[model samples]
Target: MREPLFLIGNVNVDLVMGPQEPWPQPGTEVIVPESEFRVGGAAGNTALALDVLGVDYRLIASRGDDMLGRWLAEPFGARAEAWTVAEGATTVSVGIGHPDGERTFFTTTGHLHSFKLSDVLSQLEEAGDGRVALLVGPFVIPALLADYDELIAILRRRGYRVALDTGWPDGGWTAQVRTRVAAWVGHCQHVLVNDIEARGMTGADTVEAAAAIIRPLMPDGASLVIKCGPDGALAWRGNEHVAVPAPKVDVVDTIGAGDTFSAGYFASLVESSDLARAVTNGVTVASLAVSTRPRRYR
Candidate 1:
């Protein structure tokens, strides 16, 4: 049987559209060839990817008590039983995809701020049953973010290995942001970030240098991995680095590529017990996700 796993963080609606060549000007409308509405957010995207990969995990997240919230929850089925419904509109992200697979997003905070430590603890029915809990989108969830240290301590006490993947902050990686992230990183056994985030968080130009800077701040046995889009991913663990190359494919969408990669990496790690294999699985899964129109996660 697969090990007990938990995916905790934001869950929201996503309106994806585009391929517009140039940035649109104010008061002008630019029509795109394609558009899609789907579940998104760091944990939301990961949950969807895990489902496609046939991985079992308990999802602990929140949604607003609105129509889109109801619409978003339908995709998770029974796994969303413990999800909290906050008294507000669901967070929605409008992702505009570029021709090169890069994308930009416009988002609303909505109900994400309603998730708290109590909700997380309450939903952990089988705490400590196995190992591995992924925490994502830290900045967006103020209630949970405020008690992040306490949350990690509780999870650690419950014998769950914590993995962190905080998506980019709205204000970018400022000094205060880096300092706060550093504090949290110390408690996590796994820290995953994309290439840009890695560099920005550490002020290091290269991923290797960034890992070098970040590893010292975390605990002794912690691992750090950087997702490098089409080039692939790299992981630093146990004083060594592992490189995983991504397979090339025609691009389709890149909105949740990082989130999907996180799911695949950890899932493969739990199953295979190999860092290289895990990173390989991550990039492979992400490549598949971005190359397909409907977005295949397997």
Candidate 2:
């Protein structure tokens, strides 16, 4: 039987606004388009995508004890276990989108920075055996990031299949950060990184070179997926490599597309254990996600 997936990461409320006529100068307001509030964060998006695909999974994350947190959890219902903190606000990301599909985000870390390893282990212990853990956005959780090595060791000892999506460190990939990230990748059974993240981590100019550098660090029989937006994705397992092209679509908003891809890829791998098919499914799902508006609570 396939193991159930457990997503561990940050959860936040996203206020996305877009297509303004011009940049707001000083106190003036510029509103030329649309706006919406939705759940945001790698783990939140991935868990929701898995829900849409009818995959059995659980979400373990931290949120502020506020209305936004409650709103965010409403979609997952019983499947979400969000540790609410009273001292701070829920993480919120305000995204400003341009007419050409580009967007910039202003984020407040809030409760996410306090998500600790102890909280994660408690959830994992209750998850039982034969489960896959997808740890997303370590960068956003400083407490968890500091204890990542020990956390991965504990998870491995408990027989969980570990996967990671490091999202992108704020200060770019410095030497120290790269070392730590490489160590985390070594402990994971699967890793998902975008083209820029791959290049930054490996100090390699091309995706192929970057993938080559990281592949050796991955555990034997594990897979590394490099997501290339528009172009497609590349999957590497041991000595074999497969490249799958993304389906072209009329893209609306790509806010959570990569997270959607991670969900599709890992869910398929849990079901089929075929890397090629998993990559194909990931691309297909990402295409669909980018073409539509962000998913809302059901």
lDDT of 1 by residue, 100-196 (tens): 8778889888988788999888888546654788899888888898999898888888888888997788789999989988888998889999989
Stretches of candidate 2 off by over 4 Å are: 81-86, 126-128, 294-298
Could you give candidate 2's per-residue lDDT for residues 138-175 as a string of tens digits?
88888888898998888888888888988899798999
**Root-mean-square deviation of each candidate, in angstroms?**
1.7, 2.1
Local distance difference test values of all predictions, in order: 0.86, 0.83
- Estimate the lDDT of model 1: 0.86
Give the lDDT of residue 273 in candidate 2: 78
How far out, in Å, is residue 253 in model 2? 0.5
